[model samples]
Target: METPTAPGPDVPRRSLISGSAAMAAAGGLVLGAGAATAAAAAMAPNGASGVVQGARNGDERHPFYGEHQAGISTPPQDHLVFTAFDVTATTPVELQLVLAKWSAAMAELTNGRPVGKVQPARANGVPGDTGEAADMGPHGLTLTLGFGPSLFDGRFGLEKFKPAGFDQLPAMAGESLDPAMTGGDLCIQACANDPQVAYHAVRNLARMARTSVRTRWTVLGFGRASAGANQITPRNLLGFKDGTRNIKTEEDFAEHVWVGDEAGQGWMAGGSYLVARKIHMMIETWDEDPINDQQGIFGRTKQAGAPLSGTREHDVPDFHAAAPGGGPVIPADSHIALAAHENNGGTKILRRGYNFTDGLDAVGRLDAGLMFLSFQRDPEQFVALQRKLGSSDRLNEYIRHVGSGVYAVPGGLPAAGNYYGKEFFPG
Candidate 1:
């Protein structure tokens, strides 16, 4: 369907919510966001901890130019298609010409190439690469791009660069949230290791911004529930083991995941702050509970995910060990003792979650869950660890958080004609 061009002379005309007036301009660029598997690349030439440098190769790629951004420390990819957009442009320079045509089509769909010319039996020709992931080589895809919070509600003057504690995501506690599956002004996550090459890269960037973006809510995840770099921890849908104390190395992602300069927004210093959520999982009431009450409601070890005060899966959790006709052998309302960043005062994030299903419901059950994702420089470190796991996490009695969002994600793309929020539209 490709037909939305025109925006060349250094990009910036503003007027169409049908208020008419036209005269766009343009430039180019790309990069950033979360991860999952395919190990052997702990990046760090100032790009921070990474992944996807080998294993499961279909030409494992990850490098849309960097210094931060390649799916938030690239490595996690075993499907995920996350979406969220809804910008329908009316200014901010037509949303910066849809981030300069989505940074020249996400630098050719994360280097597997092809943002155009898929002739599709042309009659008058309009294919522009929608041929369902043509050859699909780059299985380690990664596309990122974010910026919600009503895209800074002053409509497009961008409420003074909105990143200092970037809002929206408050009413916590076992959430039921569903305003048509929560908010969005723009987002795109797309990872790969193939689920149709991550749903053909967000379905060709929503069919090349079909007149300035619309699909606000997509999802689609699968497996790789969280684990990166030299991999291994992956199991959610309540089988435990998810991200086992995530935020790995690079000094724990520079003291808890990217975004520095105190996030007062110096172009969001090497950006980071996604937060998605979906969750649901009631899977027949957590498969009829009782496996020692589901390992004391996830204090761990539902088959070696370790930690009832530690035995293996990366050990370390001894939150005051005790339990012999006593009180604390892990269960401080366990979900790893309330998401243990050592009981939250140390606060960490960066999970990169997945695992989902969409099938039955009208009382048939099994709709399945956990999209969750993470990454944080300060989303109050996931709102103080989900307000202490939505008021006491005993794995919240079989999950329910139904869809939410929070983006921002703005670093990396320092070369090739620069685009994508190029510092929030400077001349």
Candidate 2:
């Protein structure tokens, strides 16, 4: 195992949670909570959206092939805690095709009726789709299914999660007309159906998405490896970068995602758990701003990653240091201000976001942003943070929420027989 090395003065932690720290961390506890919000990048001069989507993996594609932080090792072979596909579309039939091969299919969002108090898939008591129902294949399939720990978690025996799987596939970048555009029916934005992937298993679905004729919404999903030959380290679209500002895995479920607690019921557990929002960035707008203005909004420098009115990116803002009597130096409305409680541990969520950039725009537009997707324990925790940002924050001015929806991320699968969200939310 390699030793952890905290990156130099500018980089984040590069070491291990040795001794008590490691023990506490292993058991699911975080000490100090530092935050790193987006800082404005220097305007691209010519006014181009600097954002760019990562291309298909050109190197080896497998769970075991990639390298991760030292000491934090995977099995002799690589695996995932789970794999999921959030495909989008209209026409119940179109969505049906994707689920045709699966053991069960659940229409999660049909014209706006949230899967009411989700129960076991069997409770719907609709006859199985195997024999008499097998004909449903004619209609396409819609899915929010996934591969869980049983299918991805490396440590299944003692952990609260288990089951993992492996497969690779194709995908692309594109969309279709949704009622959301004309307000006819709901438009689908499947991250599972986007144009980013390393290998080929899920590509089959992407190909299907592009070809499907009946759907109103287009697909914008990406297939990640649940198991097998595909690699993804904890980094943003930037190759050498790792989103260290994020919470740990254990903290992921317990904090952000829904788990049986005094607040909610058990069915919500292994069921959420919850889906975060789809925050889109107006890359063009962001790319056109001056660095000084950018720094003002984020309170940080792009290169040094330091706060405008402060020291380093992780340095606690000396909110009171400057004026014995303070007045908006850090801008109470800034993104940093709203996300401030994250430092106090008041409310935290596991942010597993992705960076995507579509090509260029006609009038030099930039269609790219970080897919601000996160899993949460409750929608309110996230909303509260947003409430702080209010409806009109500096960040919001440059970002547009083109798509929005939620899903109950499923549990782990034991084998290939049939796995997805169906098993997690038992009827």
Candidate 3:
């Protein structure tokens, strides 16, 4: 396979350095040629300092600094380990320090380098970095951080800065939310092509924040990519193509996913709101159902993933099309129909969801499902679409919303700051 290069302009020779030189500067750790190639490709377009490099393994790397966070718009990775934490800090200063450490560490890890200065094994007095991922490349890791509504409840004098739409999501119909799995004061979304790399990113961050925050919930997820030859769309646990009509281009992202300056609070100008739902699939029950019924639940053909009214997977569904008996071919209550943008007043969310199987439940059935990650300009967009699904989606019979969280993900780090959420900290 061809090696992936950073997407954009080339860097000047004056600012460029050899692979060995870069690694030596980054704590004397030796990196493979692939990692070196990624580092070289990530140089700033104008040859400015502080360019965030891509990961090793020839996987793409997203820049850590920009107007918006990387993972939100960066193409979705193959594996995800989403985590939420409850902040234990009493003052703004303490919270600021945590963000500083996390921001610095994130930049390094995403570049396929260890956190802080790497010490020799013999000098190990509380080593700065965990060595689990020492050999593993970055594997296209992207770490996204967000603040939950509860984080602004006057804890650090941030209640006044909370965005108007940032609040605890209202209880939607048909939800069996578990307290243990729901809500958090902060959230970190780690996505990578390798599961071990993804886990390592979150593990090290959690360790760094051990004193100021505690893990509230975590969900490990993997995606089933299309196989060779005929396979086309990625399948969910329910054995249907997922995210067929997802937002993809920059035009759609600007319209649907990214928050604008005029949208609300100044701090959230280019940021986006994230909605995470741990949807539990009743695998055994669904598997026992007939093929026709299974297809009916999602309103798409099982094998081809085309709408009932259309033959091709990418063909738009004629919602008004009729069947032999004059009924709507794509049923009104079908999963696709209810969640369609046209049905929801032109609203759409960028979905970067993943499939997960966590062994079995209390009854010995597969505890498999989708860790649904949706990024939108406003939280109300998710609310509107979800309310429709909860009340009428046919797929609801086979799934339950057990875990949910909404977070305000801020824009990317500024050119000078070395901390996440530094704008929120008082001078």
Q: Which candidate is the best by lDDT?
A: 3
How high is each candidate's TM-score?
A: 0.33, 0.48, 0.85
What lDDT tens digits, residue by residue, belong to model 2 across residues 264-317?
332234434233233355665566788777766765456555545666545665
Whole-model lDDT for model 2 versus the true structure? 0.32
Residue 270 displacement in candidate 1 (angstroms): 10
Pairs that collide in candidate 3 are none
lDDT score for residue 80 of model 2: 12
Residues 1-427 of candidate 3 have per-residue lDDT tens digits of 3233232221221122222224333434333333333343443331122343434463456667678887887767788999999997665655665676566557667766565333434554455567777756667788999999999899788877898757999999868999999899999999888888889889988876676689999999988322212224588888888877888778988898888985557778789999999999888889899998888788889989999999988899888899899789988899988999888789888888889878988888899898989999999999999999999998888999999999999887654233556557544
For residue 107, model 2's alpha carbon misses the true position, in angstroms, by 21
lDDT against the true structure, per candidate, is 0.73, 0.32, 0.75
Q: Which TM-score value belongs to model 3?
A: 0.85
**Models, CA RMSD each:** 19.1, 20.3, 8.2
Model 2 CA lDDT for position 360: 53
Comparing 2 and 3 by TM-score, which wins? 3
Worst 10 residues of 1 by lDDT: 33-42
